[model samples]
Target chain A: MTTQQEFTDYQIDALKELANIGMGRAGAKLSQVFEHRVTLNVPNVAMVDEDKFNSLALKFETGSPIVNIIQQSFIGEIEGRSAFIIGGHNFADLVNILGYEEYDAIDEGHQKEMLMDISNAVNSACLSGLAEQLELDIELTNPSIAAFNTPNSALKDFFFKQKHQETHQTLLFEIKFFIKDINLYCDNIISLKISSLENLRNALERLL
Target chain B: MVNEEQFTEFSKLLQELSSIGFIILDRRMNVIFWNRFMELHSHIKSEEILSRKLTSFFPDVNEAWLNKKIRSTLVLNNQAVTSWEHRPYLLKLPSTQYSIDDVDFMYQNCSYFPVKDSDNSTIAVGIAIYDVTEIAVSQKLLENVTEQALDLQEISTHDHLTGLFNRKFFLDQLVQDASRCRRLNWGLGIAMIDADHFKSINDTYGHQTGDDVLKELAERLQATLRTFDSLCRYGGEEFALILPNTTEQQTRQVCERLRECVDKAPIISAGREIPVTVSIGISFLSRNKSLEEIISEADAALYLAKHNGRNRVEQHQAE
Candidate 1:
């Protein structure tokens, strides 16, 4: 549960607006690259209390079965950890949708690599507001599998352990991106430090 | 020596003496720097290779793939890694280790790191390749041993002559199939098959002819049974079968069919035509019954079939 006092309604609204803009940019970039129709929806933003950090992890995985959580850290004007939570009824279905041959698609490792490829494309375009940080290279860590086929309790414990002592407050956003043509549906979750959220709010307000 | 000159010389020595290979490539796939390790393995010196398009002379380098990896590294401003299993090597070099039949070239795990300019824009990609032939060889050997172990396991559970399930495997499946039938509320039929007048055949013909008759009989009976039916060589001139999902009625039809199949033809063995027939006994799986009781019932039925006639099917009567 998020404490209502940490962020005003206006600030939360600004974060959602910022996410919508980022989603638009991501959809455009992906459609241009893949030559497929893409649909993106606005994300939900909430200020998570340090006490509720464990519960926050379960919220990200509410609609998910066992999924692969790919983590990529970004640092710049506004920094946060981005995640691609990919799970489906059948991974072979996803492999077919991605157009991998039967010789390669049936393998487990290749399936994970497929997740990484699509996740990287979305993370680069949507998360961290990467376009604004052009002058300097934003140190985006290579995507790593933070957890694989993990249960909710373990995932929550992982999220709790990743919380650093210096972090004052955390903001969580749940976003969805869909490729309409092939039904490539995926959910993304990102968390930003309160200070970075402040910087992002100021930036979005200037645009407003 | 001056301090700066000594530092420069030490850096040069480290790059040249390293066991792994290293190369730097600009955005246009032009060679920027080739370390001593690369030069020694590739046998191309600095002068001839510097600033030259790597793909121009090196046919081993996959130009299209190398560019894709480099482009991803540059665009994402992140590291790109490849395992030897996924791709054996980008630049093939002859194996320096002791000769192995399957391994003639070095296996490599390569990493591409983005090299940035003063303004933090990626201008080049630095690639590091490590030799992993030893690891690959060990993994292959391990796989071969595992496959051999599986083959050994296969041999232990089959009859040496007929290649059918042996007595031990038949017992294992009997218990498992009974429990499964009880759990699923289905019927289970057990049959004991004995070739009639088998001792006379062995005494009349040679032992080899007798063996040939058994082999041919096994093949004929096997073809007549359903795929789910399990047949095993119980002992000399005798067989046991576990027929799952078969009621008493279906069991009679199946056993009668097997009896008719063997009765129809005389098996030709070693230039001799030997007439053969089999006596079959049947029992049904009952609720809350032990496997021993079911098998004993089937055995009693076989004894009855031998008493009444030589080539017929008999069912144990319920007491």
Candidate 2:
């Protein structure tokens, strides 16, 4: 695992630039799907240990009436996972924009499937954009709902149980997208396996 | 990347074997691939559907919205998803499932996916359709059952003969209304009414005439009270009225109206016109008064109305 000291300012800047490009594409695609202008802004990226992921997950703990998470894993030159989390109220807002009647006929399972479709859209767009820009190829598995909670308090324990080996660092990106007109909000998180960090760094070097 | 022939072969296989409906549209929204499931559901084979605009076949589809969804998949390279809850059905295909007969059209959840070539440019967009009629039908049935249960509960709380609140329900309401009146410092009045000479009328005429007299008396008593008042069949030839937010003078006036209403009308049953009269005993709610105490006062007042004279109104005199 590489420390923060090993990566120069230029390498971090390059990675941030890649996030901007990829997230920009994701934001645009999201805007089209919802028929509303969506804005995505990521201020910083953190490289930390796997244990810290539990803490990083706190921001996504909206404590809403319902919480749904969709996580998809990708493998190729760089291997990692992307998760999309949305609060129930925000999801209801999204459902309204999608032209669904309020609480009419959708069950929990169908709601999860609908959310997974949206997750697949954003994850594939962002990852594909990053891959295309870095000239690397990554194949993604089918998106699936990873977690569902009504009270949202159980989400922290859910993340804590997914601890990995002690040898790797996790690259965590906390990003949010907004559909301002409808007052809709959602969070997207991308975490890369520590073993893939070197390969990602090598790809960044090749681009530089 | 697969060659053109290989891709075409794959598309044909997808059209042939998949149970779910699948359709592929080019940038112009022209149908390039229509699968077997689509043919079986939509009744349009690929030979006729190929190279045709999707809108021509299903004009009910919101063109502007569909164009935006397809544009996102084609240009932005992301999938667009919609469920049956939103639009119900995209193609308006008839429901083929035997489990659900009430629904005329199939419920669909559609996902539009981008198809890319070697250069990574999106050449076409594919829609994956899933039938969700079972879920929709089940939810509908559950709501219907809840409604039926509510109707049954109403039947259980009402009297079959007079179509008024039953004795048990009135007693339950008495406790709740009495407590509310005490807390809010509002006046509550209870009146016990009995049909005068009801037994002699049954013997002189018949039990059917007696039933008619009771039914007419209940209707007149209900009509004399306000909509918020509670009317219940207390027992044989006896009925009760619970009035909230009423004073002693108001209760007397209402009781007088009830007596006049029954005395003025003659209930006709089986070609016989029989006069009907009611004696009413009234009592008002007071501070620290229990439900049993209020009922006893009303019953004593009713006895006084019978003793003083038949077919009259009497108020409980607190001693």
Candidate 3:
């Protein structure tokens, strides 16, 4: 088994560089779609478990149901997952940007389809960049969704199962990016285990 | 191992290993070849249901419909498929194991495909059942959240009385527009308006007529202002306008037009012809001033216009 401390420093550095590049691409795409200037910022990154992830997501305190696109992949020996979260407050702006009159009578199937499309585009762009940098052929699964209505504890239950199984800690990288007129927020997170570091190092050496 | 009894046992094991449920029925609709899954799901033992007419085993099954579908499949020499939208047959499943109240069993999406022989004749109907309860529940939850969000938004952004943008929304727009102007160096104008002696109109003709007066004023303001300009109910008997890319002089002309428009028509409210007029105060963003300071100056100018005389426009002159 890979140790948690052995992977922390390297993963943090790799995540920052990866987010800087990936979010830049996402920002450009959103700017073109919304026809406005967009600002992408990566203020911080950290490796956290389920408890910390839940507490951190709650601090944002958005009024609407949190819409997230989760894309999973296996990079080397590590499991990689990236999620792009859009808060409820930004729903109308997104709807208007997509050329809808109003979100008054939006149906569930339509919302799911839209979420799936957005998640697919953003995750493909960002994760593909990460894979390119790490020099790994990462296989990605179809995106899935999760939502939170109130500040309920159940928000973290789904992600906790993986954290509890392994003694070796996972790498959790948090990135925040935004575009101006559209108010696009790309909260991208990448996670992986320590055993995958050797393959990642070999890939990086090959790239160099 | 090669004895006749052992050969028969091996054939039974081979029949049970298949994933697809295989059921053989004679022309008289006698049940035969019920697999393990079919027995478990339908709660009908092979020994008990064998040689019994399929319709007799499950009394709810429509014999006429089944006969018609079977005939069609045999004539066409192709496998006939039926979707969940069309109910194919009612199976005698264990009621305790699959309750109607259970979401999974409540909405079963099953497909019925006909099994055909080499000679292109219908042999049996294979039923494939899938549970889509989770997808349906998730879809409903998403709809509920969206509907609740829209309801909350409508309550927050609109004025209860006149259906205009409320004062809170107007302030928010002022702040947003101010920031945009600061960045782009664009000009913006703010107009403060008060209905001339609105209190006496309410006292004389009653509050109902007063409400009609407010609604009429809102409609006229909407008509007179440009589409880009936002007119909001600032408070009781007062309204405000936020005009982007408009200088003080241009805003003054807009205000003058609005003033004349209101004075020319006597508002007809609840069968009462009420003569109404309004005082207007205009202010534009100074190069260094914040939105709040500009609004205060506009309010001061409105005070000046009301003091001098009602029904006229006054431009704010910062000291």
lDDT of the candidates, in the order given: 0.76, 0.78, 0.65
lDDT string for model 2 (A71-132, tens) is 88889989888778777656566455444445622566546655765677667767877788
After superposition, which runs of candidate 2 have C-alpha atoms over 4 Å from their true positions? A1-10, A60-66, A96-114, A164-169, B1-20, B27-30, B51-68, B79-111, B116-120, B128-319
**Which predicted model would earn the best DockQ?**
2
Q: Comparing 1 and 2 by TM-score, which wins?
A: 2
Candidate with best lDDT:
2
lDDT score for candidate 3 against the true structure: 0.65
Is model 3 an incorrect, acceptable, medium or high docking prediction? incorrect
Off by over 4 Å in 1: A1-5, A20-42, A47-112, A124-171, A178-183, A191-208, B1-17, B56-64, B99-101, B139-168, B171-319
Total backbone collisions, model 2:
0
lDDT of 1 at A66: 66
For residues B108-137, could you state the per-residue lDDT of candidate 1 as single tens digits?
A: 878788887658988999988898999988
Q: Rank the candidate models, highest TM-score first.
A: 2, 1, 3
Model 2 C-alpha lDDT per residue in residues B177-243, reported as the tens digit of each score: 8888888989999999999989999999988888877777778788888998999999999898899
| Model 3 agreement with the true structure over B124-203: per-residue lDDT tens digits | 65544443445545666799999999889766967988998999899998888877876888889999999999999999
Between candidates 2 and 3, name the one with more favorable DockQ. 2
lDDT of 1 by residue, A1-208 (tens): 3335656798678667767776776676556544577666655777766576655565653355666777887788777787787663336545544444555455766666556656676677665243442222345556777776665455666667667635646777777778756655676777776566557656655665
